[model samples]
Target: MAHRSASGSDRSPHPGRSLAGQLQHLDALRRAMARRHSLNPADMRLLWLLSDDRARTFREISEELNLEQSTVNRQVNSAARANLVQISDDQPARLVLATKEGIAAFDQDVDRSLNGYRQALERMGTEHTAEFNALLAEFIEAYRDIVQPDEEP
Candidate 1:
């Protein structure tokens, strides 16, 4: 069986093209969110993590975000300087927590970014959106397994 191309040329989509396209879209969304919030991905992630009440040490954040400890530490320092995060040295181990301002900022960004997605889901209908989300989750899990086989079952 032979396939014809639109321009009468034998052309095939490249393997992993779809995944790359999806990643590009995700990156674009992240950049748009950053621009809208005036914060970078690292800053936003830190705020989001802290907003979730997941107070953790630098090491824990590094592992959870799959970012280098040094990079995470630097962002934490920057956030602290910006009054977006507070360092509690009174604790046995220093903990990072989102300050009131950080929470407020994060909430605004969430409403702007995440809520937009929520609205899109609502427009898509519950059942269709649920199925789409489920499939996206499966694809992400499979990608993780492929990228980090040692961490997979």
Candidate 2:
């Protein structure tokens, strides 16, 4: 059944649109944070995983991130070109390791991101930050309950 807003405009799918808008806002925030940092978050994520100086095979990274092997290879190649990581010389594992440069980049990105997050939390105030945290947790749980059943193994 179609529903009308206060202005009598039909808007049955409004809730769906609102949910999509929230997701879009999250994406925009990520992009903005990326821009404010030395490395984009996507690249930073890979560097973060390897920050312990542990070399991992592409398959390991792919499985860990639930990404395809080819996609992981592409990301690794990009990072290598930027001198952020190194691919092992033809070996069974063909392990990928983060460079010292990569570690520095990751540290910079984390610093910038944390500064932004801290300022945002300060603006939200203690009570509001706590309330928002609880509400966000509840939303995630509710949304997961609604969506997880259809997900594949």
Identify the candidate with maximal TM-score.
Answer: 2
Per-residue lDDT for 125 in model 1?
100
How well is each residue in 50-139 modelled by candidate 1, as lDDT tens digits?
Answer: 777778888778888889988988999999999999988987878998899888887887788888788889999999999999999998
Runs of candidate 1 with Cα error greater than 4 angstroms are 1-11
Compared to the true structure, candidate 2 yields what TM-score?
Answer: 0.77
**Taking the tens digit of each residue's C-alpha lDDT, what string does model 2 give over 1-153?**
788999999977667788799889988996888887878655887998999888999999998877898989999999999999999978888999999999998998898888887899999999999998899899888788788967653
Q: List the residue pairs that clash in candidate 2.
A: none
Give RMSD to native, each candidate.
4.1, 3.9
Let me know the TM-score candidate 1 reaches against the reference structure: 0.72
Q: What are the TM-scores, per candidate, against the unseen true structure? A: 0.72, 0.77
